[model samples]
Target: ARVAGFGPDTVLLMVLPLAHNYNLGSPGMLGAIAAGGHMVIAPRGDASTVFSLVENERVTCIPAAVPLVVNWLNDPALDRFDTRSLTLVQNGGARLSPELRDRLRKRLGCQYQEVYGTAEGLLNLTRLNDDDEKILTSSGAPICDDDEIKVVDEDGREVADGERGELVTRGPYTIAGYYNAPAINARAFTADGFYRMGDIVVKRGRYVWADGRKGDLINRGGEKINIDEVENLMLKHPALHSVALVAMPDPVYGERACAFGVLRAGATLTFEELSRFLLEQGIAKFKLPERLEIVPEFPVSGAGKILRRTLREIIEAKLAAERSQSAGPRRGP
Candidate 1:
């Protein structure tokens, strides 16, 4: 409620289900009671419906998921509606790609706030007046002054500022246990009690930016590849609407990176063009995607996070089929 800038005159719009525990709705349903505001729940979670509600109700703020934002950006009718009343658009429940964030800023012409949170409890947010670099780069500072956080290496030793490591936290509101799962809880929490977020991140002062999950890495031979880093660069290609980088099995290298891109409306991009763009971005030769798959949309988890595992499976199956075809039909005894 405090971080959302909710007040007596604020008009907050809710597009996701009320059951969703996004930071925008910690309690009191968009903090209407906590801060004294008006909350408008959308009847249908569609772009047109959302735009209409925002325009009619004079919605000042909306806390939404990545997919809703993507649909709004790609919708042709977007310009026809008036969203000038919007003061802020908060995105969470999934990563906000650089390209998507830029588009949202330009299209809505409002403050775009990003947050990192989970159902288990920790929350980080970029303030409405934060500098462009902080808002666009780091995930922002913790919501509470006493929220204890630590970035540590694989050995559980705290890493230096700006060094990539896993983020662990134990705070006033953060849960100490996960109900009845003792076996799972043992590995999920540290010996002393901090909850292991399993998120690879870089911390500087109170600001932290997540790279991806600890297991979300690919090893191309002996070289370690950060999938999110490569995907961020690939997303800059003009023809892509969204990009997902995942691993595909290889006989020699063990695993290789493959890119899956959803094309922008009326925009087509070839693998050669994308590769050239990534190279021009100054990425290393080893980070270039070995294979490209163009799709209409990438699979997403129930929480709206991109399901890279599903994408990896898709690409690996495709490779297997290609290999089988190349070898031709086998003789049957």
Candidate 2:
């Protein structure tokens, strides 16, 4: 409640399920309850519903996924709503694009905070008073005084500040181990008992900067293409409302980065055009999206986080079908 700025006067917008992690999801509902605040629950994140609730209920804060806010900002009817009531928009579950963050500040007149958390109970929050640079670049510091965290390299050695390494943490709120999952628990927890978060990050003092999941890093012919960096650069393109990058199977490299995008209204984007734009932004050639898949919306989990695995599955299916056709139905003769 304190970190998210919820209080008796707070009117939070609840577009996500209560089952979402008690750490950062549930629209700050747990904090709202602790602080004696009011909540407005909406069935969906449709622009009409969100805008209406913000106006009618005078919602003061919203803890939401990155995609929901992008949809709200791109809606043509946004200007029609009186959303001056919004004071804060806390982004979690995904990395928010830099371009979208600037747009939200100008258009909505609210503060933006980035959060890093998981069902395992680690939480990092950007303070409301953090400078523009800190809020824009790092994911913020630990929310609890008892939360113990560290960054370490491949050999289980701790890394210095600003050096990238895997984040491992354990705290009063963090679970000791998964329920009855010995195989996973053995690999998931450290010898010293820290829970391996499986995320690559850089720590400076108490603040953290996420570099995407270790598993999600695309290896193209042994060259690593960090999807988060590529996706942030791609968001600057005029036609994309939002973009997510995931690995697609390649015969030679074994894996290649492919981008999945949701387009802005009336916007048309082709692979060549986006390629040119990214190159203009100075991304290396290997990191270029080998293909683009446009979707009405990205597949989301119950807690409203993007299902990147599902995105990978979509491209794999398409490639399998292509290879089957190229093989001419396995030569029935």
Candidate 3:
């Protein structure tokens, strides 16, 4: 937690499951203990309990996922609790939109740190002393001085700075190979040993900017739609609490963009309204989701990352059922 500016006086609130590598091995947890800081573990699924812990324990630092932060911001009980004691807020596991970052800073009155890391052990972090512009736009510089990062194309050749490419890294803490998974290890690492992180990123000077997962792109009639880009724009809408964009099967276009959203508590939004909002954001017409699904909650992994593959399966199955119903039984000759 020293890199994040946590100290012996810092009281940290741990809400994420300890089973996840991010929570178990994070500097926020280990460094806090090393510094003799107090750690309070909060119960899952209740935002009120978290707020109460922060207010009662005077929590100074919190490491959480982006979705949890979004839920806390959307909770009506936010204003009912005193959260001024919170000073350091670290978010990882998912991308934090510039809009959400600004809102968290203003509402929580805390310094927001955006961390970029992988389960495989590559870590990049933005410091607490970083300016708002750097914190909002870049995911921060590498944590270790000797850590190396490279953005490469399909041929494994490094790309120019500021150009988007798959991010690869090699560092002291990074894992060399997965246990008992030789097949995966072959494709997941380079000949020289850099791990392929499967994320597309752009390097601008000292900072790296994430552009979403390489496989998360949706091709709608040869046009590629960056899922994270659409989700980030959608999250800027006042009614949305969470959003996941996936590609749905479309016979005509081959594939179409579909957005699944969870509205804020007691808030209502229509597909037309959401589409109009995206249009106003200056996104291309083809990039706008042709279909919308309102979900109560998104399926998340143990690490708190949204299960977009599961969501795509749900929508594809529903479309198949609809098509089956539309086609009547064939009569025998």
The collision pairs in model 1 are none
> All candidates' TM-scores?
0.93, 0.95, 0.95
What clash count does candidate 1 reach? 0
Q: Write the per-residue lDDT of candidate 1 for residues 168-248, one digit (tens) a residue.
A: 999999999988999989988999899999889899988888887877888899898998789778867778777788889
lDDT of the candidates, in the order given: 0.83, 0.86, 0.87
| TM-score between candidate 3 and the true structure | 0.95
Arranged by TM-score with the best first, the candidates are: 3, 2, 1
Give the clash count for each candidate.
0, 0, 0
> Candidate 3, residue 200: CA error in Å?
0.8
- lDDT tens digits, residues 1-333, model 2? 788788899998888666677333422777888899888988778888888899999999887878788888888778888989999988888877667777887888999988887878888888989998777778888899999999999999999998999999999988999889999999999998899999999999988989999999999999988888998998888899888999999999999989999998899999999999999999999999999999998988876678999999999999999998888855556
**Of candidates 2 and 1, the better by TM-score:** 2
- Candidate 3 pairs with clashing backbones: none
Q: Judged by TM-score relative to the true structure, which candidate is superior, 1 or 3?
A: 3
Candidate 3 residue lDDT tens string, 1-333: 667776789898888887676676566678788888878998874678988999999999888887788888888888888998999788888888888888888988888988888878877889777887888878888888878899999899999998989999999989999999999999999999999999989987657999888878898999989887888899989898889999998999888999999988789999999999999999999899999999999998876789989999999999999998899788899
